[model samples]
Target: MNSAEKIIDRFGGQSALAGLIGKRQSTVGYWAKKGTVPVSWHGKLLEIAKNQAIDLQPVDFIPIDDEKNLLPAESSLPKATHWGELTIGEKEIPCYVLNTGDRVFSLKGVVVGLMGTDGGQLVEYLKVRALQPHLPSDLLPAENGEIPALFKFDTGGEGFTKYAVGIKIERFNELLRAYSSALLDHHLSAHDSTKIALTDRQLQIATTAVRFLQASSDVGLVALVDEATGYQYERAEDALRIKLKLYLEEDMRKWEKTFPDPLWNEFGRLTNWKGSVHHRPKYWGKLVMELIYGYLDADVAKWLKENAPKPIRGQSYHQWLSGQYGLKKLTEHIWMVIGMASACQTMPELRQRMAERYGRTQVQMTLYLPVQH
Candidate 1:
């Protein structure tokens, strides 16, 4: 019996094997006709077969071929020990993008989340048509004993060798962008369903979350921001001041000058205080709240310009702020945004790190002083 015969007999029939792979019997027969399993079904087929406790080998595809191609072979593929994920559409496809000196990876599982019947077809779609070269290279198979011995597709074959995948580090980002773009075209995306109200820094937080997913990096967004901002309140105030210049400078005149003064004053040029001369002694928290709200207004405006749908973007500040989910609510969300950003200065991973290090989930500053009125 031939390799096809062996597979069919082992699994009952071509129809049974095809059923196991969620493919038509004709597709299974085509594999038998070509005397080779298509690469797309390689991972899934192997996975399902293993789950059924069937140990498959490469010779099953090339039963008539000579013995030389059956042995373990060497190939220079990257050493990718770190596992990561690339989320597309709604599914998060697990992958690895590691760089060990010159080599990148052996990609057998990259297509697990893609829309291909095999890895070869998916590679063709990405590299040939999409013009994305950073995708895994079609290197010959690396045996289970090789340096990059991680080839999940090599099971057992009879040709010179099956081709494996390797991606260059330089092209990793490009690969992600292309893969993400393709996913967006094929499936509904988060961007399409949600409003974009995050400021650039806040957007950085989102992107950092995504980047963390991509490489499964050990660090968190808040930690990375802390390294950049030194976890200082003054730095956060300065950054928020820059944000205010973009969207809320004029509305800010409602508060008196020298009330708290400009949060950041880089220039020594004398600009007269232009705030209203209202005569009410105020609580310090009220003044801080006003600045926080103004900053949020600007931050939301910028986020809307880039992420929100057209009608929302066109609304004036009053109209936008007056909506059902207006200032009072936005104030809280925005507070979380800036507060989270500020907290990053001291707590990189924030809640998790805090919980672990200090044995706490919340913190507060309480001043105990006798008040004489």
Candidate 2:
């Protein structure tokens, strides 16, 4: 028998278990039908099991293979191999890495961290009509009206079993996207009841979703997960090599005026250069190397410096960057540098700003000064 069925039988059948737990008999039946118990009821059941002298272990609550209509007696389920917490602002969520390489956050952590509500409430919210459209297809209720199956893991310790229920990292992003979309729809259709219904806690969740979406892209989220779980250190050494391949071109592109004139104009103003901004001093290249390119991964900067074709006259280092990902990142970095330069009144102020933003040690001002000829 599956875990849920065994538990029900131990409590002297579904009706007796329902009476002991103050839940409807159908609810107990549903648990048996799903081959797993809702985690919210675990504590009450465990306590009752203790009082009744029934043999109940935390591992008894691990979900069975409902897909095959069989117990996991012959084959073991996957377990968590790593654990960590992801902190965003003041809130922290417990995260895990399965032996299968899936990254997940506990369902309780997601709801409490993002929504400030009980995890069960989020499950209920997902069942509502307003959220169904925004939810991923896999997360939607079955056509027979059964709740979607949770992706449970064996957390490898009794204390950790309470946190075994989790959603994958990709699903977490999708959940955030859904919350964001629903919130947008609610705001746009304030008068329409058919749109998303936002309770105070759900509004909080939607706000968190908006902030998360604003701050991170798919790639940024992956890196955040890696950093949180310390998986970045365990990653294959070729990870950097693969990333560099994406950011650097194998061959130089046709030279274009990548750096805008405003960047140079602001640089001249901040540095107190008396020379014409149109004919920038050669030291401008050194400044670009330090402030702009220096913001990239140290190895990326080194690779660019050592391998890129030496700038021939009007050509520049940026021409060596791949047009797709590299140029996009470079453009964003350049604009941020220009913004910093525009904010500062003098060269030292600019240097301080760059140092603060990029975590660079203060450098000698003369390093960027023109030759005093």
Candidate 3:
């Protein structure tokens, strides 16, 4: 194992280290890619290690730089001395984050620049409201000439140093956005939810799916299940979208109005088929979850064949289950089979895994299939 991996292992695993750094486990792995640690991250890792009772030093991560050519070209660039500047709408804000989730905005220089003329007055009002009278750590302390008074942020990273405070990776962009918005009105904006970055294909699939939702006054299980189907395969997003939309067209023909907020905004983000290396069809995937519940030639499929659906056009029960109904019935059977499977095991293992993955165990779970169509 490389030094980075070794450090991560000592903290239990990648996930533990990720939790400490307030980053995704995958993003943290990037720092340790190919058994090489990024020079920029060397100091950060050492500090984290020290906090965890593990001994690590700067030299343990990189060469001593006695000779210039020994290091890679990219490593020589000036490292980010602090948590770094965050860009929001072409405006850069100097900010600091602490392990305690406190964010200290550096209002020394840009106070007037960002807030216009009355920026200082607005900041003064926020100083008392977002006040942190007691200093939590030296990382983001209020310098004498700083803004009205330093305030603790609602969110931040898990480490802090004298010069800089670390901000959580997922929260960095959001903090910048909220801070900028707050300066305008002197009050924090609404919280921003983490959004998944989608590719072109995923965006198309989501966009097309929203149209179907928009066209329907009320939707059934099939329509909902169709949202995430066929996203498991690479390059199949558009094909699946086309097939599902055509199949559900007649069902959605009743209403031609646009989609509600949840369909367009919420489901659009959820249904993004971000099938890249960092993200895969692990969870929230109707097809993959179907397999986990034995939807493919297994108990759930057998149950679905025997119990769910009505025959159509003289086709076999299975053959009749096509398109939207097929997806809908498949989804219904998945939940039922999951319940039955858990019942048989007394399922200490499954229950524990469920609690770990989703905060709730089988006993605590409830299913509502929308009373069918």
Candidate 4:
């Protein structure tokens, strides 16, 4: 192992080191990538090491001569220009965009984050899992038992140099899919005697994989990384405006029955409204704002509230939504609300379900807004 790996291990892994030093796990990952901790952090790290009963020496931070010889001169390695954490549940995998525009994840971070296992075990896991007939043929390991090559990158600061291992973001995602598939297969075949028993760590990995795969596509993952690092704002100043345009129309469309009858029926049932569902109580408007629109992207929902036409004598807020993407999103959100309403027996129960499913929106909605004259 290199100095960086040794230091990380002695400190009880990347996450533990990060917690000890009062820094983000991604920052510790950054140090690991650079193959050395910053001088400023050295004192704190040593102090933490001593308290933790770790045998960390100051010289351990320096790269060994043999390791240096193995690496190409510093000039050959690409420099990271942008970097951020890809948070999946409690785990955060440090990711970076090179000056060359190539995106990659910290090699050790990816292994530790997804597998909750040792970074050194990744290659061997891939080799074993790749040979499984149940796994995809396109998995990371080759038929000859070779794994994908690790990328080296420079993450040095002024007047100093450091290097760390990385895997291309695409390869990282591929590994996630492979591991997810393997774990899921194991989960499904619980009765098989030949299969190794699933550990708690593997179960956690499986849960994380399902959540990540459900929410993020390859493009979405890139966008998430950009958002986390503030690179998206740098890339496009009007990104929110552009996104709002997709979810709101410049002009109101012809009024239609955008909301289904069952939605109001359920609302009426829950609220115990004696009046007809067709002529919903004025309070229903507030519920719509809270339950339906609240589920949207917070900024998009805010833009709609401020800019979209208010409910006039004849038209409602849904009528002002764009016919294409905006209406599609509205319809989807309505069904989700209706689904929750259908499942709950009481108002508090429905609210609890909503909180569990969507959480509370950060933007507060006014309960009563004057209808436009």
- Measured by TM-score, how close is model 2 to the native structure? 0.41
Candidate 2 residues 171-288, lDDT tens each?
8788888888878776866787667676665677677777765544633665677799998896654444334333324344322245777889998898888999878888888888
- lDDT for each residue of candidate 3 in 138-234, tens digit (9 for 90 to 100): 2123445333233223122223211211233333223233333333322222343232233343233234333433322132343355467842442
Cα-lDDT of candidate 2 = 0.66
- For candidate 4, what is the lDDT? 0.63
**After aligning candidate 3 to the native by TM-score, how far in Å is the CA of 335 from where it should be?**
60
Q: Give per-residue lDDT, candidate 1, residue 155.
A: 21
Q: Per-residue lDDT of 114-163 in model 1, one digit per residue for the tens?
A: 33223333333343332232234432122332322233223223333333
Per-residue lDDT over 1-373 for candidate 4, one digit per residue giving the tens place of the 0 to 100 score: 6567678987779998888878899998987786756544555777888887888654455443344453677677798886655544334456678998889877666666566643454666565532244444444566665554675777543334545677787766666675566676676567866554445656666566655554456436646877899788655443443343333243433222456788899999999999999888988887877787666665556655665442444545454343333345556678888987998888878877888776553355779878998
TM-score each candidate: 0.29, 0.41, 0.18, 0.43
Flag regions of model 3 displaced more than 4 Å.
Answer: 63-373
Q: 1 or 2: which has the higher lDDT?
A: 2
Off by over 4 Å in 1: 1-16, 19-24, 33-47, 56-163, 176-373
Ranking by lDDT: 2, 4, 1, 3
* Residue 106's lDDT in candidate 2: 68
- Candidate number of the best TM-score: 4
lDDT for every model?
0.40, 0.66, 0.38, 0.63
List the lowest-lDDT window of 10 residues for candidate 4. 247-256
Candidate 3 lDDT score at position 186: 26
How big is the RMSD of model 2? 18.3
